[model samples]
Target: MTALVLSLAAVGVILAFLGWIFPAGSVREIVVGSVMVACLFANAILLLAGDGVVGWREAWWNVLLLVSAVLAVAGGGPLTTSVLALVDRGNTRAQSTQKAGEVLRGGALIGCLERAAIFASVVAGWPEGLAIVLAIKGLARYPELRSPDQPASVTPQAVAERFIIGTFTSVLWSVACAGLLLSR
Candidate 1:
């Protein structure tokens, strides 16, 4: 069971890298998101079953920890992108894309770092770190989000929506990945 969980996590990490390396598209996003969802489900089942009892000192256990954390950080980008795409489906795609791009520059990097910090904090048993991470992110983004210098096509509401949705998606994915390590 432990081996299976670790293998799934490793595959998830690889798929996430592929998603990142390739141009952003529906197919890549779907594949990566599906694999990540599979990994999260597998981890949940393992936790529920309570079968794997590997100690922290074991190499395999450590490998699982490392892989899961990497997956947490890497997988979030695709997952969040997919979700934002879905939310944007109802709007004028080109305009929304432009607004989002203009309002949330460097969001992908910020999201990756956010996921890493969230995962590390959760795994380290410091839940307060989640608040700190979010607070810092919010503060840093406040200027742009408050008054985006976008065209008339872009609204402040749209920017705020994107920020909220992306942050929630990334944070949830990271926490779920961290749960895999906590299962042990």
Candidate 2:
């Protein structure tokens, strides 16, 4: 059962990477995101249900931790993109067409690092680290979020929405992945 859980997580991470590589809002992205979500949920269920004893050696536990962490970080981008698409479904074509990168530059890299930090913090029994991570991210991005020199096509509201949505999604995903491991 432990092996099954790890395999599911690894597959999800691979699908997530594919989704991240694909164009945002594309059919391939959606399909991959859906499958990744399924894998995550299934893994969570198995973990929570206590399918069997996970009496493994230290090395196996470490491998499980590594897989969970990778899934937490890699899965965040596709999950956040799916969420943003759902939230912005009612927007005009022009508004929707504006790439997220234009408004929140370097978000992808930041999100990956953020998810990794959050996952590690939670799994390592340092939940307070979440607050520190968010604080640092907010402070680092404050100038860009407030700058009036942004492209005309990108509104302040749009930037703010993207920031909030992306952060919440990324954080929640990491926490959930960590929770799966801790539940065992």
Candidate 3:
């Protein structure tokens, strides 16, 4: 059991680094997806093998859950960014070019903060907080989405898609991370 715990921790560390470095793409996506799936599987295996006790002491399990939660939150933003970049890759619209850096920086920051909050909320057993966070996010970004004063570099649809896709990705990743922790 200790060996399994340590191995998962090691894998978590490596995956965290890879996520930090690559953030997105086929490689990043595959690695992140695989690690997440493994986490889920590990929890199931432990539960089944231990007859619902999970076997590990509270401290050990807590540490594992904490580390996994942090890794998932940290990786969520970059994964979202990478996926969104891929989604918009073929878009040669002026909106994709103009102020792209600014938009990306802002979006990434929001994603990081949002995912962190969502992850914490779920882990702390406050699922309702997700609604508040998402509501605030939607309200905060609504004006930009509905803005009629479009410059050549911006489009309402693009902005909306960015918000929608980014928010969904961030929230889903956080939820999956939380679910993994709860599984065992």
- Per-residue lDDT of model 2, residues 85-180, tens digit only: 877778864355235458677888999999999998998899999999999999999988899887876667778888988899999999988877
* TM-score, cand. 3 vs. native: 0.75
Error of 3 at 91 (Å): 2.9
Q: Is candidate 2 or candidate 3 better by lDDT?
A: 2
- Candidates in order have lDDT scores of 0.80, 0.82, 0.67
Which sections of candidate 1 miss by over 4 Å? 52-57, 93-98
TM-score, model 1 to reference: 0.90
The lDDT, on a scale of 0 to 1, for candidate 1 is 0.80
Q: Tell me the number of clashing residue pairs for each predicted model.
A: 0, 0, 0
The residue-by-residue lDDT of candidate 3 on 35-117, one tens digit each, is 75565457547555654325667887777677667765776765676666677667867545223433434776777788888
